[model samples]
Structures are given as structure tokens and as C-alpha cells.
Target: MRIAELGRRTGVPVPTIKYYLREGLLPPGERTSPNQARYGEEHVRRLRLVRAMVDVGGLSIAAVGEVFAALADQDQEERGLVRALSTVEVAVTPVPEHEDAEAAAQARAFLERQGWRSDEDEPALRALVGVLGTAREVGHDRFWELLDGYARLCGPLAEADLDYATDGPGGWLEREEALERVVVGTVLGDAALAAVRRLARKQAARRRFGNPRADCGTEGSAEGGSEGPAADGATAERP
Candidate 1:
């Protein structure tokens, strides 16, 4: 197939596809002529993977490049691939000035309690510290109380994720394919899980609060009702 056909099949525009090629995100196609190149199914697959990482996973070009480099490295061991995947899986935002030493200590302590081996310089650990610090700064210090419950939930999920990655089909997959699956799965699975969590939260809120109508009280009168003051300083009275 040609570049045009590859773009059409992948629903990606030609210029964007060309941009990916220029960025080294997509592999070069086979040269058919001086000005023509022929792409194959692999190109199609790669393009889709690139789109998922950039558009859905929200990875920057640099991050995507790093991920691809790791994926393409024939000498990378499984442990190296996991570390690479971890780096791309989380977004490392710039840390604000005036760090909260307490939150950082708390995060370290929590990690230690969990018996998880993490380095202080790891991006994920740094990100966690930043989050914890910000949570405290925003007066949500008690939010850390949920750590234990969240960790419990994460333990099983992480185990299941490893199980799927390692024990697929017969017993263990080819190293290259396994690495690719882990990268793609980690990227796409995060988005899928977030959406599911949001949906579940919506359902839980509806069940607990009985929807907007219940929260706003019966039709209009605020007398003896649970409806709070409206934003405009008006009482919600019964119709």
C-alpha cells in the first residue's frame, strides 16, 4: 500500500502521517521509486499505535519517541522494558517551588510501609510526592487517609495486570510481542480504567444522593428542606 492508502485506512491525514515519519515515530516505508514508497500492514499497525499514544494516551512527541526507541531496542531486557513503560505511563509535571517536606516524608513512609522499592529520583515517586504536597497545600491533608484503601485496590489490579502480561495464551508470550502489548496496554488501559472509574463514581453518586432533583429539594420551597443557598444568594422555594 502507498502512504495515501495507509493514511486512509488508519483515518490519519497524509501530512500528519508524514509528520510522524519525520519525527521518527513511524518507520520509513520501503522505497518503490525515487519519489514513491510502499507501506505494509506493519506501517498501518504502527500508525494506529502512534495515534493511540499521542491522541488518547496524551504522550508528547518526545515521550512517544522514547517509548518507540525502547520498543525497537532488540537488546532491552524485560526489566528494562518495564522501566521504560513506567516512565511513559505517567506524566511528570514540573514541581512547584516551596516543597512540603511533610508530604514528601509521608509519601516516603507510605511507600516504605507498603514494602515497595522505589527510588527518590524516580519520576513516578517524584510525581507522587508533588501530588501529596499539593494535596496538603490545598487543605486536603486528610486525603492521605485513603491511601491504605487505594493501595489495597491497586494491589489486586496490579497483580491482574502482571498476570495478563506474563501468562497470556499458553505460558508467557514472545518477549518483543509481550513488550509491545505491555506498552500499548498500559497506555490504553489507563484511559479505559479512568472512564470506567468516572462512570462508577457517577452511579455511586446517584445512588447516594438520589440525583439532582433530590439534592435540590421538592419543586421550589426551601422551608424545612435540605437545599442549600444557591450561588446567587437566593433560597430555593417550592414552586
Candidate 2:
């Protein structure tokens, strides 16, 4: 594929893509000819991932770069992943969305029940309530049930994050850097959560109910059967 095609697929402008290339944010494309650079499937995949991180995941360029590096490092550890995931910031931006009466009622009820103060952006709370409101509107009861379990798991987790983020590395975080961290953390953290969710499901089945598929003599399945590299390539190194 050509650079034009990459831009088209990624919805990024050609000049911006070139800027990324120049900034070393993106790897150099193969030279099809002296004046023409040809991209391939790898470039396409990477560009899409970058766009998703910036546009949807709300990552800053520096943070996005760090995340891309950590993702490809293969030599990274859990702490490295934590560093990458902590690069994005969550701000209290009013979305300017008009909430329907019922949706408002549902969200209010959900938040009230969860005891989450809406005084801040509250990414975790917003995500949970949004999932519930959307689910109820779509005629599903399982979303609330899922939220119940997830909330029980996440409440303490949030406290842990607060403890660590404030006392650990993120404590030194500057304001401008917060956005970058917010972006990186939001994307990597989501990936981390996905890794955990996958493990949790397997654990609920294998050990919670005692399936024989897992190796015996342990309290639970190893790494809870996490994906690809187990929990992450971060947790276990490849020899």
C-alpha cells in the first residue's frame, strides 16, 4: 500500500503521517522508488492502533510513543506496562450530551447505589454507569449483574491505584504530563484490564468450579490463563 492509502485507511492526513514518520513516531516506510515510500500491512495495523490510541483512547503524542514502544519492547516487565498505562490523564470534561430522563434516572440510581461521588471526571464510575444505562436501554439485565461483580472488584482496586499513583511514580506527575499519561494509561490500562478479564473468566470456570484443564496443586490456574504471553508479555519474559 502507498502512503495515501495509509492515510485513507487511518483517517489521518498524508502530511501528518509524514510528520509522524519524521518525528520517529512511525517507522520508516519501505522505499518503493527514490521518491515513493510504500507501506505494508504492518504499517496499516500500527497506524490504526496509533489512531485508536489518540482519538478514542485520548493519548498524547509522547505518551502514545511510549505506549507503542512498551507494546513492542517484548523485554518489558509489569512495571514497564504500568508506566506505559499510566501515561494518560482523565479530566473532568463535560461531554455536553443530553441525557434522556430515563437514562438520567438510571445513571443517577446506579451511581448512588455504587456510592461514587460524581464531583470529578471519575472514569471508572462513568464507565460503569454508562454501561448500565446502555444495557438497560437495550433490554439487558446482565449488565447490572456484571457491574455488581466488577464494582466489588474495582472499588478496592481504585483505592490501590490511588495509594500507588500518589505515593509511587505517578506522584511526580506534572500537569502537562498528566494528559500524556491519561492517554497511555487509558489504552494500556484497558489492554491490561482485558488481560485480567480473560483470566478472571477462566479462573471462575477452572478453579472456582475446579476444571481439570488447569495444572493441579496450585491455588489457581497459572496466570489465570491470560492471553498471548500470560497476563502480558510484561509479566513473563520469553526465552
Q: Which numbered prediction scores highest in lDDT against the true structure?
A: 1
Residues 145-210 of candidate 1 have per-residue lDDT tens digits of 778777888898777676666664346777766776677778877788889989899779767976
Give each model a TM-score.
Answer: 0.81, 0.44
Per-residue lDDT value at 88 in model 2: 34
Residue pairs clashing in model 1 are 220-237, 220-238, 220-239, 221-237, 221-238
**Alpha-carbon error at 1 in model 1, in Å?**
0.2
Instruction: Locate the minimum summed-lDDT window of 10 residues in model 1.
Output: 215-224
Please give the RMSD to the true structure for each candidate, in Å.
6.3, 13.2
Q: Estimate, for each residue in 148-189, the C-alpha lDDT of model 2 and write its tens digit.
A: 566798777666554443346446454324333444445656
Best by TM-score: 1
How much is 151 displaced in model 1, in angstroms?
0.6
Candidate 2: pairs in clash: 59-183, 85-185, 87-180, 87-181, 87-182, 88-181, 88-182, 88-183, 89-182
